[model samples]
Target: MHVESALRTQPRAAEGERVETAERVDAVERAGLARSVEHTMAATSTVLQDFLDGRVRAAAARSDVAARLWADLADGVGGKLMRPRLAVAAYLGIRGGHGDDDSAAIAPVAAAIEVLHTAMLVHDDLLDHDEVRRGRPNVAGATRARLVGRGLKERTLADQVQAAGLLAGDLAIASAFALVASAPADPAALLRVVRLLAEGIETTVVGELLDVTGALSSPRDVDALAVAELKTAAYSGSMPLVVGAVLAGADDAQVARLGAVGSALGVAFQLADDDLGVFGDPAVTGKSVLSDLREGKRTELLRRAYAMADDAGCALLDAHVGRADLDEEGAAAVRRVLVASGALDAVRELTRATGLRARELAVDGVPEPLGGYLVGVVDDLVGRGH
Candidate 1:
């Protein structure tokens, strides 16, 4: 998916008041993830939007369209804090109880999750060569028009787009750090959280590099499990929970357990994402189906299928995997190959097993109420969008 899709924040709450709040975490699950996190994220979104709006208005006054673009950009990047909620859930798991004060404390950390997500999207879009995002044009997409308007050639546009996207990724990272720094956690703890954020970024980058390298290499040397765990799983599942737990003053053992939960959940979530990348509803997912196929992602499915494919099948796949123009028919053919080879089932079984592990880990050392809530959340995340 493109940066726009990745950065599309949750919708804003209604104006002139704080959004109506949901009482319990179960209430959130019942309401559906987008809505649950929409309400949870609404308050913080309002603040971020208002700030961006004011900035945009100021820029418009000065006739600086770039400023307006920047502000508008921020508005679009605000969204659901699914990963960060993992963090909050982890915190609650360790804290063993809840109240008004506890809820208030968790909010900022949750918001920080969104911040980090935004950073990842900005970078992912650049890497993917996507010009659009979240059903709208991205910074690069928007710039295309301006570039054409300025009489730039298509080749020049390509160069500038890539460069600008790289810069945008850097800016997104800066913004994520600012958000985490601005939260109400203890100074020392916040510093550690920030460090963790950096570490997650590094891990994700390494995964991305490996993924790209595998795509281009003759032998496709990377391990599918390693790629899935690092690129998609750890950050989205484990890091957020661990960070939240750390923020809530979880002891080392509790924090470690939360990390374990996150690791397993992250793997399951990534596997589900892989499945959805092939099989999801276009409307709900807000993207074309089989996007990963078109992108030639070196997912577990691809790796497993490749290994099992006969020489003829491997030769057929080698020609197909990285083709940007792979169409619906091509993707379907690939699905057929995966299914016939049993690779898809293998990946699915892996997802189910890992999800079970996550649930077990999530509850192992926590207080009852929060642990139960976390286990539910882990379950929700594991098969999400499937």
Candidate 2:
């Protein structure tokens, strides 16, 4: 989507009053978003638990497997609830208020989008071989723990755990579709939601494939950006807004504008995340600070570092990046090179630019309160420390 020039023409508020007013507005919007997220989370929990209970009762003979799958899926819930919140925000943006009837109508679809996100995260953990998420055992990790407690042989346990994780991801995907199908929306709107969900899955899979290819073979800057747009932007960012707007009967133009805003927001979010992957504290991020360097993940940060580095810096990067045995000292050396080459500053600047673009798009045509909230979200996302 093209960026609207008119967005830049909007008048800015005066300095001190603007700051005070913006803070007050942000606080109010944050409180509203928090309440919406809480409602969505409660509804999502009810839907998932009810589904799990019915499935377990129906498959009594295989109750253990059913329960395990539900546990895995449940573990993926209750994080920031970003997707559902975005959906609710977009819905409110279009509908003008969060009345009881509007909330009742929106919660089911919001829950569906959250469920869809959980499904993708389950699969993503498997793909990334991440054993922990949110500082707890992920699906694969939990499965491995269960199998290990059973005294299974190492090889057999690994195989069984992988299978369990795969099946849990599959169940989550199927349940996502089921949730959307049962949402209380018009038949035509439901059709659009279904199409959006299908497209999200397809786009994410293609992006994942590109990510794998980048890691293994190419790892170009363009490829890295493409992966971010397809994998993170489309499903995690744009689709939620689109779904909510469609449910609120938004016409095609509004939907398109929201999609563009979401895309820019998503890209900025990922860029900030890339910065964290390299420079953030492990305690705050709930991850090893060196994991990205160890894996040589194809992020724009790394791509820029490579391009800007001199021969000695390039040699340092080549020697340590992606090395499985890389130690703390090696990672430190790589970080030094990145800083010396100005890659970190370059990426930070890009992230700020992207956030500005998203803010501009939100102000262009998206209604007030929602537009203001969207800008607040961009600020919060790009400013995240973890």
Candidate 3:
């Protein structure tokens, strides 16, 4: 979910060609595209902070949870503002990069997208039993550390952490919807955006069920690709773009086209993210190689590997893949199986294929700037190793 990379990634002529074919143009319309991204990002950040501040004021009496909630979420808000970037880019691209007013107008919806993303991560981390995200203490991890420091022990500590994370996510979700519903778009369009957000959440919940169950059931039974689509594509991928399109007054056909492209791109992005989780450099990706393996995540690689592995390989995976206390040694062993069974290669191919599909659809399915912009974004994301 590298938001900046997707929007900032330009097709060969993304900037200069639009303004001048032979030379890169620095003034007027070319600069507008860059300004759109900058304006939307800054506005989104301000909205997020204001939202947090309002919450703090409203709950100032018992500031404990609110304080920690603001601290944890606000601190992590800078980068990875992926969904908002997509939403704004899609909106501007659909509008042919002409409406700078739309940038300011779209701020609430974009901010809602960012807040919604944070809520998802908080819940996602909780569900995966992942105490860390982006190489830092997630809410659960931070809560646990605080409790331990305060002399709380065992079950009570865990229970308190759970409560904090769950409530924090709930609060964010409520606010996200509020923002979408209140965005300065046509009332009808605003309603559509809100519905899209709700639907995305519903879709995500279904995918999450499959994902956590993925750890318990046979890996072969889980449709790993479908799971990725459901979990990440709905809210994280297409919803933002669709929301933007709706706000921009795109027609049904165009909205549908963008949605499909978003879906393909979202799935591709998740696949890349999963790959990074397992194999990327933590220093570069801010993710760990061990967490996904330890979670026994039924990633496409794991599913494909299970199908492709021999008995010995299966036995090796069964031993170390899901253990809570799994260490570097166990992770290495799983990686060995992934590589040996060609699951790594297979997943990588699928990632590229998915990204390519999105680009193909975008080329003729949408307008020029959007089509070209998404093409470049997908290319960069697909090729990005970290």
> Which candidate number has the best TM-score?
3
Model 2 C-alpha lDDT per residue in residues 337-356, reported as the tens digit of each score: 98999999999999999999
Pairs with backbone N, CA or C atoms under 3 Å apart (clashes), candidate 2: none
lDDT per residue for candidate 1 within 1-386, as digits (tens), equals 68666455323433212344423543554334334333444555554555456556765787675574565356457545578666656665555434445555556666656756766776678788877788777767766656777878779989877766666666657666766776766899889988998899999988888877887754345586788788877788778878878887988987788788778877888888778888778777675665677787777778888878777677777767667888878877777778878888888898889888887875577655556666777777666776
Ten-residue stretch with the least lDDT total in model 1 = 9-18
Pairs in steric clash, model 1: 4-133, 4-134, 5-133, 5-134, 9-78, 9-79, 10-79
lDDT of candidate 3 over 237-296, digit per residue (tens): 788889888888899999999999989998999899889988998877777788777777
lDDT of 2: 0.81
Give residue 159's lDDT in candidate 2 (0 to 100): 83
Q: Ranking under TM-score, best-scoring first? A: 3, 2, 1
Off by over 4 Å in 1: 1-40, 50-65, 96-100, 218-220
C-alpha lDDT (0 to 100) for residue 208 of candidate 3: 89
Error of 2 at 190 (Å): 1.0
Residue 159, model 2: Cα distance from true site in angstroms: 1.7
Instruction: Give Cα distance to truth, residue 344, candidate 2, Å.
Output: 0.7
What Cα-based lDDT does every candidate model obtain? Answer: 0.70, 0.81, 0.81
Compute each candidate's TM-score over C-alphas. Answer: 0.82, 0.87, 0.88
